[model samples]
Target: MRFKEWDDYIDCLLRQVKFRPDHDDIRAEYEEHLEDLYGELVSCGVPEDEAAKDAVRSMGDPVEAGKLLNSVHNAFLGWLERLLRWAMALLIVLSVIPLLSVALAGGESLIGMAGGYRDTQEHGALVYSVPVGESVALDNHTISFDEVRLYEDGVFELRYRDRLHLFDRAVKWSYDLGFSEVRDGNGNTAKGGSGSGGGSFLSRHQQYFEGFSPDIRKLVIERRGSEYAYKGRDFRIEIDLSGAKEAAGL
Candidate 1:
């Protein structure tokens, strides 16, 4: 190879060395060194081919040099990766602090709110009330009453100590869209067995409430324009009152 040919090859090799940190300056210096070597070879009467081979031999392997350069490049990349991870960790902690504070300030203790019911019932002009504690073992289930009357057709409220349950099953099922036709004892629709369905879930739910009465520990009744309070479990719904005549009948 002539001096010009060898210079062209070195230029191409330098262009391919992407990982070289100071490629331009190093390539220029290498070119000058090759020029000096070519002058020496020409003065010594050495052929161009032999001088080119000698220059290439003196320069160590390009592949090994490239590997070392790549190692340096990857080390920089690794440092950048560690810096990014630490920054991300700091950002995540900063984001979670406000959420934790909000949760604590809400006073929404799961264990504290889980124990009894303050129930209210109203029938026409009468209102019956009770306070029942949850069973010893905490069961997080909502049991509802199908025919629970609020003033017979008025206002009802449900309360729970450890969990929520249903006081008015009719409204609950209605809201839940659990409507089904009223079925008779023979598993057929009632009244001439026409089977024409009505959008009332209570007709089917009554069966589940049968023989399943909770012990009413205390009772408060507002009936016939008067209020009556009772202690202990009692199935008897007494109707004694002294007020407006309508309350008397209530």
Candidate 2:
């Protein structure tokens, strides 16, 4: 078991084992196991390199070692994946209450409207719409709005907001029919920009697009209660659906 060229020999063996199509983590575990056995051998009486060769002898076949390592590592990875999935499920369940609270609060103000909304994938575009008042004149295949209704107390008022995709301009629109909240955001990584101070609408919007890059010419649309913000390479569009159900025409 005591040989001089042990480390070099074991290295060659391990390299050869890798060519047999074993799992990578299995190979890594066996590699570490071999190193530990070598350390124990040296600690007893053998020379450094000789101890390594003795260690390799005790390791059985390289293919067998790889199989054992595969069993252990597969179990470990399965456990880790389950833990991650449970963590995600827990996070989503906990977040639901807070999200509902915000939606309810936003629905209370005059700028807020009560209605059902739907999102459809059609005509190579994503469409969202809210039907106000009777809901009949609103429900349709196309997402574009022809009319909207704003509700204050028990009164219903008509309003309209148009959608457009513009490029190379920083455009802002007022969510309130009377221009109550403006979704104008300006900030950099340094200054803690405009979104921090103005427009709760924009603050929530920035959260939605946390990792997305922004376009300087992006269009900002302010509906009654929320901001629909999106950026593209040549063009950008931000839709404010804050008080969308009550806009004007429905």
Candidate 3:
């Protein structure tokens, strides 16, 4: 559906600006935007011609807008945003390739990467799972330890199975579940494994740490006293890595 009024505004604007690929894109976007606004106004008891004029007016100073866009589209900055998007999308697809290939080949892939009931391999990693005897009570929910895993590259992860109904079930590991000798990370990814209604609750926490020596035998993850005062006593997770020394091929 072509609006004569909209086409006129775009034609007038384009005349003031040099013809370029960017201008075409901008013109198309503006056309859609104006059409939407016009449709909305018509739905709300506004005449089509009046709506078209009002929409163009709202954009303000057609000549100035065209000049600004002409400058923007010419510079490297014009295509930078789109270039970055394509780059990021390509990177994501590349990263998923390894996982997808392994899965399709029937090799041991996401079978254990996710909190699945698979045997943890100890060849390259001190991979194994163990249950926790204690549980931490936070507000209305009690977080019980489901399992803990130590990967090949010293990548440590904790899986919590039981989670009560709640919107935000974030645990401040530094304050809530403190690892006295471990270090905290700035940006981390936590994917809820095996939850109700697909993935409402249940979480897996990955953390990095320091303070390891050649003789260091175990990685102890302990929580500092809770500040919420919900759970009275403090509990800890001790991952025995007698075979961990060999994981690094030391």
Candidate 4:
């Protein structure tokens, strides 16, 4: 719509703008320019209303002008604006993907977080035993590798009676240790999951892992060369699972 006054003309030109720290400055500059135009037209014997109309009309389409002004004031310009917007959007997508993945993984992630809920649920009941019955020394600490379960796929558990607070952090995942690894009979490393280590000073420290290679003759658990070295030795154990299927009667 055409505007008849300077205030109306400036408002029309900036109606679509939502962002601007410079809106007042821009409006004042436009008002001064239009006032000069109106004065020149009146001096030439033009009517007041006609002069105002002519001045506002000469500024072009209000909507388009507003768009131009918004673009000029927005921080990023042209292709740089487009690129940065896309990059920020992509970062949000990448971030949400993990949370979505965990959510989509059913209640397993939640159970994992509740830290031993698997042992209480029906799925945990399906967790049959594959005996490891081995131990390794770290400082004065003796970490005993215990049972394994084939149904849960690479899950293993261990406890240390001699020392609590085994690692710097009370609980840590297998990936936290450079030395800790789950290897199948063929010597290929198996996928490891969240394992934890934390307990009271007087209490035994228990930790579990979610990782197992199916139908393997035996699996080796070792954490020898990692940064969490124990008296210059790497912690290691072996689970003879050649008869795991028969043992669990699966």
Cα-based TM-score, every candidate: 0.24, 0.26, 0.30, 0.38
Residue lDDT tens for model 2, 1-250: 3344444444444554433333455446556777788778778889976777677788666555544444544655666787899999999999999888755544542132222222212222322233321111111111122222212322121223222222213343422122222122342111111111122221111111121122222213232323432212111224344544344332
Please give the lDDT score at residue 131 for candidate 4. 55
- Model 1's lDDT to the true fold? 0.38
Pairwise lDDT winner, candidates 1 and 4: 4
In order of lDDT, best first, we have 4, 3, 1, 2
Model 4: per-residue lDDT, tens digit, 1-250? 2244767768887775655546787888888888888889889999988998888888888889888888777744545666788999999999898767645543443343344323423234444566556666554345555556654533544433333233455353222332246676676765433334333222233345444445667767777564654436766667776766776676
**What tens digits encode model 1's per-residue C-alpha lDDT throughout 154-240?**
233222122223233333222111112222232332221111111221111111111111222222221122243222222212212
Q: Is candidate 1 or candidate 4 better by TM-score?
A: 4
Model 2 stretches astray by more than 4 angstroms:
1-28, 63-132, 137-157, 160-250
RMSD value for candidate 3? 18.3
Which candidate would rank higher by TM-score, 1 or 2? 2
Best model per TM-score: 4
Q: Per-model C-alpha lDDT, please?
A: 0.38, 0.37, 0.55, 0.59
The reply for model 1, stretches above 4 Å from the true place, is 1-76, 102-109, 119-155, 158-250
